[model samples]
Target chain A: MKKGIILVLVIVGLLVTTSFASVEKPVMGISLISYYNPFFLALRDGAKEALDEIGGTLLESDSQQDVAKQLAAIESFISRGVDVILLNAVDSEGVIPAVELANEAGIPVVTVDNDASGGDVEALVASDNVLAGKLCGEYLVEKLKNEDGVPAGNVVVLDALPVTGVLNRLQGFYSVIQEYPQIRIVSTQNAQGNRTDGFEVMENILLANSNIDAVFAINDPSALGALEAIDAAGRQDEMFIVSVDGAKEAMEAIKNGTSFEMTAAQLPTLIGKIGVETAMKVLNGEEVDRFIPVDVFSVTPENVDEFLEMATF
Target chain B: MNPFVSFLYKNKVTVAFVIIFIFFAIFIPNFLSLNNLMSVGKQIAVNGIIATGMTFVIITGGIDLSVGSLLAVAGVFCAMLVKSGVNSIVVILLTIGLGILIGLTNGLVITKLKIAPFITTLAMLSILRAFALGMSGGRSVSGLGDTFRFIGRGEIFSIPFPLFIMIVVFIIFGFILAQTKFGTHVYAIGENEDTSNILGLKVDKNKIIVYCISGGLAALASIIQTARLNSGQPLTGEGAELDAIAAVVIGGTDLNGGYGRIIGTVFGVAIMGMLTNGLILLNISFYYQLAVKGLVILFAVGVSRKK
Candidate 1:
C-alpha cells in the first residue's frame, strides 16, 4: 500500500507540472446543438478556420440536443475562463441559466444559428430563417402556379416545432401560402427535425394525404427524408419538395432533378465565421450589433452548380 | 510478487480511475481545477444515479434498456404536470410512482412470462419511447417553473444539489446491497436461479424488487434531468442505458452477474465522467472522442478483469 501511494503521488506531481506548461492564448469555447447534423459540422469547420488564423484555441462540445448537456458544456467553458462562448442552444428557454452563468463570469457569449430566450448575449450570428421559409414557400407557390397557371394544390408541411428558428421558418411559409386562396394545406405534422423522424412522419402523411402536390420540409434532412419516402411509395413524380438548409445532399438532389426542387440555403459557414469574428470584435472592446444577420439564398436546379461546393458538409 | 503490483491488481478499478485522472490532469488544460472537477461531478450525477440502480439489476443477471426510455416518459410526465400547475413535490411523487408502476410491469412480464430480461426491456424501451413522444406530441415540453428547477440546479454550500442526491442514493443502495438478505438472494439468483428458487430464497420476489429499484432510480434521474433542463424533452435519455451498462461493466461487474461492488461502480462513473470532461478540455474532435471513449472503456474493463 505504501509503495502504491508513493507511485500515485509521483504520477500526480508529474501531471501537475505538465498542466502548467500550456501556453496562454485566446481560448474560444463553442457548444453546438449536436454534431449528428452535417450543417453543424460545416459550421465548426468555418469557426475552426477563423480561430486558426488568429492562433487561438477552439474548444468544442456536442450537446446532443440535450439542454442539460449544453449547460454542462457552458459551465465547463466558464470554468476554463474562455475568452468567448459560441452557443447553439438546444432549447431557447432552457439555456437561459447557462448563459446567465457565462454572464456572471464576464465571458461574452455569441449565439450561433439559434437564439436564446434570455441572457446578456453579445450577438446572434445566424441566417435569416424567416426568409428561408418564405423563399421555400414562394418557390413552391411559383412551381404550383407554373404547373396549373394558378396556385391550386394541396400542400403538406413537415414541421419541426421545437426549434424557434424552424418555427420562424414556418411562420414565414404561412405568411406567403396563406395569401393564395386556391392553395390548401392538407396535412401538417412534426418530423422532430431529423431525417429518420422526417421519413416516418412523411410516410404517414403520404398515406393520409394522397393528393399532396408539394411538401415544405423545415430543413434539408427532412426534405431528403420525405423524398426517400416519396420514392418508396412510387410517388416521386407526383409531388416536389422545398426545404431550408442547402445541405450537400439536397443540392445533389436538386441538381439531379429529383423531386427535391429548391432549398433556401442558410450560410452556416458564414454564420460560424461571423460568430467568431464578432467574438473577436467584442474581445477587442468594440461595440457590435446584438443581432448579426447572415444572408440566405435559394438553391435550385438551375443554380446548383454555383453553390455546390459551399454546401459541402 | 511485488507488493505494489498486488495492490494495483486488488484495486484495479480505483487504480484505473487514479491513473486516468492523473493523465487528464496532465494533458488537458484546466482539467484539474476545482470548478471543472465540480462541473464533472454535477454532469455525472444523472448517469451515476441510473447506474446505481442498474448495478442492482445487472448483479441479478438482468439488464434494463428501458431505463433510458423510462427517463423520457417520466420527464414528459413531470413537465406536463408542471405545465398544468401541479405542485413540484406532487409532480415528483407522481412521476416516481409512474416509474415504479412501469418497472413493476417490466418485472411481472419478465418473471411471470419467463421472458429474457434483455428482450423484455428492449421491447419496453420502444414502447415507452413511443408513449413519451405521443404524450408530448413529439415536441419538448418546456417552460417548467423555477420552483421545480431548483431540484436540479440548486446548490448547497457551493455543491450541486444533484451530487448530494446521487451520494444519498449510492449510500442507501450500497448498504442494501452489502448488508441485507435481499442482496445475498440477488447474488444467489444470478449465480443460479434454479438453485436459489429450490433453496426457497423467494427468487421471484427478489427479482421483482430489483427491477422496481431500477425503475424507481431511473425516474429519480428523470426528475433531475427535467429540472436541470427546465423542460421535459421526449428525446432526453436516448442511448443512456448503454452508458450505464458501460459504467457497470467498467466497474468490474460481470455480464453473467453475481460479482460486483457498488464502490467499484462509483469509480466507474468517475472514470467515465473524467473521460468526457477531459476530452473536451483537451480539444479533441467529436468524432475521435467517440473512438477514444470506446478504447478507454475496453482498456479499463480489461485491466480490471481478474486473471
Candidate 2:
C-alpha cells in the first residue's frame, strides 16, 4: 500500500511538471501507424530531424494498427494542449472521430501518408498513389508489350482492401491497363498487403489460372510473396511482378534476379520531414497547402543500385 | 418420430455442410472446378490441422487460446534457423519441441497452480506473441530456401501437400480419441472431474498430454504456413485460435467440453472455407461477408442443437 501511494505520487509529480514544461517548446504529437515497418521508421527519423532543427519537441505514439489506440492518443494530446498533431492513420475513414476531436480542441492536424475523410485538417502530406500506380502500369506496358507495341498477357492483381491509398493505386493501375483490351485480368484478390497473405493468395490464383504473365501487387510485400509463389510453382521465368512501396526486400529481389521486376518508391522520409515542417508553420500562424504531394518514382533493376545506396544511409 | 427430423438430429453438421456446398457449387461460377476445389483444400488445411488438436482439448473441457501465438513462435523459430543455414530437419524438430515445452508449461500452470484453463491459456497467448515479436525484433524473418517451400506448396497426385498432412493428423488423432483408453478417460474427466479422479483416471497426466498434442499440431501448421509464405511473419495467425475454436464448436462440440468428433470438425472447417470462397466468387464485399459468416455459424449451431 505504501509503495503504491509513492508510485502514484511520482506519476502525479511528473504529469504536473510535464504540463508546465510544454510551454517552452512548441510540442507536436505524432501518431504513427507502427514502427515495425522500415518505411515508417524512416518517416519517424525524418520527422525527428526536422523537429530538432526547429527546436520543437515531438511526442510520438505507435498506433500498432489500432484505431482505438490512435483515438486515445489524440484525446490525450488534446487534453495536454499540444500545439500541433501529426497523424499516420491506420484507416483513413476510421480516423474521422479522432480527427474531429482534435479539430474541436483547436489543435491543428497535419496528416502524413494517410488522410482523414472527415473533419478539417491543416495539411495533408502523402504520395501521389494514383500516379505511382500509373507509373507501374506504364512500365509494364513498355516491358511486356510485343515489338509491334501491342500489349497482351494474363495479369493478376493482389490488393489490400480498406486502405484508401492502396485502393487509389489499384484504381490508377486499372485505368491505365484498361486501355489494352488484350491484357486480361485473370484474378484480383485481397492480400491485405501482407507477405504471407500475398503468397497464399497468389498460390490460389495460380491454381485457378495456369497462364499468369504478370502480377500487380499493391505493395512490395505482396510482390515478394507472389515471387515466392511463382518460384515454388517453377514459373518465375514466365511471370513478372510489379508493386508499389520500395521496400528493401523488393530491392534485394530485383538485384538478385528474382521475378520482382519493378516497384514505385514513395518518399516516406520526405513526407515525414514535410509533415513536421508544415506542422511548425501551422504553429507559427502560417498557412500551408491543404494537400501536399510527396514525390514518388519507379525503381527497376537498372536503378535499384542508387536506391539501395540511399537506403543504407 | 419423423424420419427427416431423426436424420437431421443424427447428422445436422454434415447435412448443413452438404447444403451449403451444393448451393455454392451451383450458384457461384467456377466453385466446382478442380482448381477452385484444390484452392479451398489448401486454404483450410492449416486451420483444419489446428482444429483437430483443438477437438482434443475441448473434449477434455479445456481451451487452448495460445495456439495462434504458438504458430507465430514456431514459424519465427523456423525462419531464423533456416536463415542461419541450419539443416531443415533439425530446425523442424527444434521448433516442434519448443511448442511442446510451451504447451507443457501452460498445462502445468493450470494443473499445479490450480488456475483456470482459460486464464492460463489466455496469459500464454499474450506472453508467446510478445516473445515472438521480441525474437524477430518486431520484423518479419524472411529469405528461407526452396526446400522449406516444398512442404507448403508441393503436391502428391494432384492433392496439396498441406491437405495431405491435415488428413494424416486427423486420422491419427481420430483413432486415438475413439479407440484408446486414454481417450475414454479424457471424455470422463470432461464429463465430471471428481468422478474421473475417484475412478483412478490419470486426469492431470491426460490434460498435460492433450495440451502437448495441441501445441505440436499448431507448430506443424505454422511450419507449413511459414513455408507457404517463404517467410516467418511475426504477426501470422493473429486470430487463428478463434477460428480453430469456431470450427470445433460448429462441428457439434459442446464448449462445456465432454463430447465432440474430429470428423465433424473437418466438415466445420470445410463449411467456413466454402463460405469465404463463395462470397468472393459472388462479388460480395468483405465486410458483408463477415456478417454472413457469423449468421451461418449461428444457424448451423442452432440446427445442431436440435439433436
Candidate 3:
C-alpha cells in the first residue's frame, strides 16, 4: 500500500512539473478587502477565470476589511515579487503607501472596484457609481408619475456616510431628483450600507414619517433591510425602494414583487474581468487607461429575472 | 450631602430610565406608540440577552470580551447547519455547546495561568473572530427557513419572541444570582479572590461556570440575532461586547465587581435602546449619535458614583 501511494504521488508530481514546464505562468497577487460581499466573490471568480485562461497563477489574500491587514498583504505581495498586484483596498487612502511600496519594488499595481489615493497605480477598474445612481433615479421618476402628469413623493434616503462610493451614488441620485420639483426628500439617515442597519434605520424612519412614498438606499443590503421594515409596518404596498448593487437578494426581492422596485447593477464580475485584463496590460508594458469605468444598468421587476441566474449570493 | 442627592445616587439607573423615557415620549412624536415601543423592545432584546449573562460575569469581576465573537461563531454555525437541513433543536444545542466549550477553555486558561480576564478574553476575541471568518469564508451564511426566523421575528401576544427570550433569561439568571449559593460565591470571589480561596470556596469552579453561562447566553443571543437578520454574518456582533459592557456599567454595576444587580442591567438596556431610537427621531446625524452615546455613558458612570 505504501509503494502504491508513493508511485501515485510521483506520477502526480511529474504531471504538475511537465504541465508548468511548457509555458511560463505569470503570477498575479490579489489583495481583497474581504470576501464577505457577494459582489467581491463574483469579482474574484471573474479574475480567476481570466487568469486561468491566460495560463497565469493567481495568489489571493483576504484583508478582513482592515487597512493595516490590506497593507501587509500588499507588502507581502511586493516581497514575493509577483508579476502584478491587484488590490481591492479597504481604505482607499490608507492603501496609497502600500501601492507606493509596490511601485518602489518595480511591480505594477492595479486597483479594482476601489481606487487608491495618492499613488501611481497603473490602473483602476470600477463601476461608474454615479451613473448607477442616476439610472435608478431616472427609472424612479419615469415609473412614479401620477395621473396629474407629475412625479411627486416624500422620499427617505438611506445613507452610508464615510464611504465615498455611497456618497457619490447619493449625490448622483440627488442631482436627478432635484430636477423634479414636486418630489421632496423627507429624511436622510445613515444605515451604514448593511441589512441590519438598514432595517433599524428604516424602522426609525417609519416612526418619524407616516407618509413616506419611496426610499433610496445606498446599496442593496440596505434596500433589502428597508423592505423588511416596510413589511413589518404593513406598508409594503405603498412604499417603493430603489437601490444600488444588483445583488442576488435584491434580485430575489424584485422577483417576489416586494417594495424593492429597482437596483442599479454594479456588475462586479465584469469589473473583475477588466481588472485582471488591465493588470496583464500593465505587466506587458501595453498602454492602459488610468481609469476604466464599467457600465452599470438598472434592474427592475421588468428585467430582474434575466439576471437572477447569473447573480451570486 | 443632600438627602435627595443621596437618593438619586442610590437609584441613578432607574431615575435615568424614567427621565429618558419621559423626555423622549414628550419630545419625539409617536415615541410612546405601541408599535414603536415594541420596535425598541425587539432591537434591545439581543443586547439584553447577552447583557444578562454579562451582568453575571461582571458581578463576578471578570469581563468576557469574547462574547461578541462567540456570538458571530454561533450565529454562523447555526445558519450553516440550518442550511444543510439539520434539525433546528439539534442545531441550537450543538451551537450552544460549542460556545460553552470555548468559554470552558477561557475559564481553564484564566484559572490555571492566573491571567487577567480582560487580557485573556481580549485575546479570545480576535481568535474567535478569525475562526468565524475562516469557517464562513468571510461570507454570510444565509437562506435560513421560516421556522428559524420564528425565534427572531415571531410574536406572541404582540411581543417579539426575542424579547420573550430576553425576559426569560433575565428571570432565570437573575434568580440564580440573587438566591443561589453559586451566586454568593461569585460575589465573594469578585470582592476578594484571595479571601474567598482562604474561606475554602470553590472560586475557580464558580468562575468557570460563570464564564460558561456567559458563553451560552451569547450563543442564545446570536441565534435570535441570526433569525432576526435572516442571515448569519461573520461581522454580526462586531463591537457588540462593548455594548453589553456599557449596558452593565450604565446599570450602575461596578467594573471592579461585587456591586451590581441583573435587574439594574434591564433598565440599562432599555435606556440604551431608547437613546438610540430617540436620537434618530430627533433627526440627529449618525456621527453625532456615537458622541451622544459616549456622553451618556460617562454621565451614567458619574451619577452612579457616591459623592
lDDT of each: 0.87, 0.82, 0.82
Deviation in Å, model 3, residue B198 alpha carbon: 0.6
- Worst 10-residue lDDT window, candidate 1 chain B: B23-32
TM-score for each of the candidates: 0.88, 0.54, 0.53
Off by over 4 Å in 1: A1-25, A137-163, A173-217, A222-241
Interface RMSD, in order shown: 3.0, 21.0, 23.8
Query: Mind giving the per-residue lDDT tens digits that candidate 2 earns over B73-179?
Result: 88889889999999989988988898888889988998899899899999999999998999987666766757686786689887889888888988999999989
Q: In model 3, which residue pairs have backbone atoms overlapping below 3 Å?
A: none
DockQ values of all predictions: 0.41, 0.02, 0.01
lDDT string for model 3 (A98-141, tens) is 77668887888888999876568888899998898898789778
lDDT of 1: 0.87
Residue pairs with backbone overlap in model 1: none
Top candidate by TM-score: 1
What is chain B's TM-score across the candidates, in the order shown?
0.98, 0.98, 0.97
Q: Give per-residue CA lDDT, model 1, range A178-219, as digits (tens).
A: 999999989989887779988999999988886889999998
| Candidate 3 accuracy as TM-score | 0.53
